[model samples]
Target: MNEISSILAICGACISFYIGAGFATMQEVVQYEASYGSRFLIVILVAAAIYLYTNISFATNGNRLKLNRGGDIYGVYCGVFGEKIGKCAAMFFDYFSAFFCFMSFVVMCGGANSTLTQQWGAPFGVGAVTLTVLVVVTVVFGLQGIVNALSKIGPIIIAMILLVSVVTSVTGWGNFTGNLTKIDQGTYADVMQQVGGGNPLASGASYGGFVILWFAAFLSELGAKNKLKDVNIGMLLSAIFIFFAAGVCCVALIGHIDATAAADIPALVLAEQISPVVAVAFAIIICAGIYTSATPLLWTAVRKLADEGTVKYKAITVLAGAVGCGIACFVPYKELINVLYGLNGYLGFVLVFAMVAYDLRTKMSLKHGVENETAGIDR
Candidate 1:
């Protein structure tokens, strides 16, 4: 791909990957950041700063390393802490990718089933099966197919979200003010305590950490295929886009805090107020976002286990999808998400710490070399 197309593809992939079932449905925002009231603003700004720096680092460092397997970079940095432990952790995280993707797939399936049943009286089983089949077919084609699917779906979802956010903000300005008033009445301490584990800073930091883990391997592959400058620019643009889109969405959701607070699909509730047709349209967009997100995740997990373009790889993909569907059907989707993702977020923090240490050491070494070279020239 040319630089422009590569950049766009990277941008699309980043957005689509991050805006999974919870994000598109606004459940992530509502739970992670929004429910905290005024504290969410702190979360947004802090998380954005961390996201911007981390994503740029992921691209640049990943391009420099040119990793063959995603876990290889961990081996490079984790040498100080017993290579065996590091490699084991890396492998563990790789396997965890499947678990994460599986949960997301289930969440999306459940979301689709609920939306369809509520809107059109469609059977939940039918919706779940249909979404699972489509996702499986998309994953069977491998990385290129996943990227193509996401590149198409990502922009449409972003546009629809931006439109909904803007319109809702304008029409619900009064409610927005009312919500803000409600938030202002509560102390920040009380707000954070009520939200996630009584610590707003921890919640915000975990959000950044969890997101970095999500993109670590996937972005490494993406960055390897493109020029460093292009990847850097793409990441910068993607960060800005997310910041704007997220801000608007959060504002929209807060506008009708009471209704959305209890909603399974908060965005759907907001959309329905505008029109039933718009709500249905938003549900489709949610499914597309889910597909885009799940495709890469499934590919990432499968690639770890089997070589691409092989019969074994194809077989694994189908089997994995089938297992995932069965799990989705049996598990209570929301409860699984709460437990799995919450635990993953903490684990992700450890990886973030390692990354920061490695980066700082590398920078200091480069600076030391530069100073020595200058002294030699002076001599």
Candidate 2:
């Protein structure tokens, strides 16, 4: 086994895994892609670009700024907003991230369950329990374990997805040719064909363009220290892979069969056409992807609580997971996906705030330095 840095692995994992769960799922294929506001595959690719930027920046800031958690990261904002506003906003983003974290875990568990049972022979609940244990175990090791997975399994999974899809497409060249053409004519109704039926992603709200840009910045920040610089390049590469692999695969399955964009596991929908067995394997991989996606958010949220100096991590993790499981029991799994995604998107307002804070910090540092220089000259 070749040795690799854990941070790079995690960064690669999230880059490939974050938007990936939705990539082949009904919501991703039809809702986010064909049916949503922009209703374009281009939008997803662009979103991937935004994701790459923001996450990488955040991580870089975390490292360069000694930002272990939200406190260090938010210090820039505090310098700008005069503490009060900055603190409130920081608290909001952190808590909101945590809430979303809980929501993500639920969605992952549900998706994993549905995939295992529907695509594989395993019972749905079995998948849920298994994932629950996995999240707890992985996160207990904290960021290191997460980073290890990101660096190691992340690239392999990315390769697997591409390799499988490419093989499938080339082998079935006849289907690929026609399906590729059909995708050019995308629509809202086309997305409605999936499992979690929703009217596509739409919002009447606006936060100027900052929401979009801030998200872009945050995404770029997500890359771990080692692979941080590769974010933008990685996203562009990943986006092309995502669009062609996911979109084309969906079309192949429909093949003039008329399928909904809403199928929860659209990849599996496509995978089945190749082989029922392969489809099951695809579902397992997806389930693992969900686990990969959900755990980070969950760990971060609990870690935030610990960083506040308010709680024990073990206790906090248990409490947080318990709350998530409770909600999972009641909230319909499909709806949870929409709610969590929209909620995260709502953070656009604060993106500008985070940026301004950063700018102010730098300016103040420069100004203070120049004043000291002037004092020396006068003396």
**Candidate 2: deviation at residue 313, Å?**
1.2
lDDT, residue 26, model 1: 80
Task: For residues 200-317, write the lDDT of model 2, one tens digit per residue.
Answer: 2222111112123222323423432344445434444544554555455433333422343456565676566568777767776676676776667677667756742334887787
Candidate 2 stretches greater than 4 Å from native: 1-10, 16-20, 24-26, 36-39, 167-257, 307-311, 349-353, 356-379
Query: Residue by residue across 198-277, what tens digits does model 1's lDDT show?
Result: 36677677666667666766777666666888877877777788778878887888787767776767888889878989
Q: lDDT of all predictions, in order shown?
A: 0.70, 0.52
Backbone collision tally, model 2: 33
lDDT of 2: 0.52
Off by over 4 Å in 1: 181-195, 367-379
lDDT of 1: 0.70
As a whole number from 0 to 100, the lDDT of residue 325 in candidate 1 is: 65
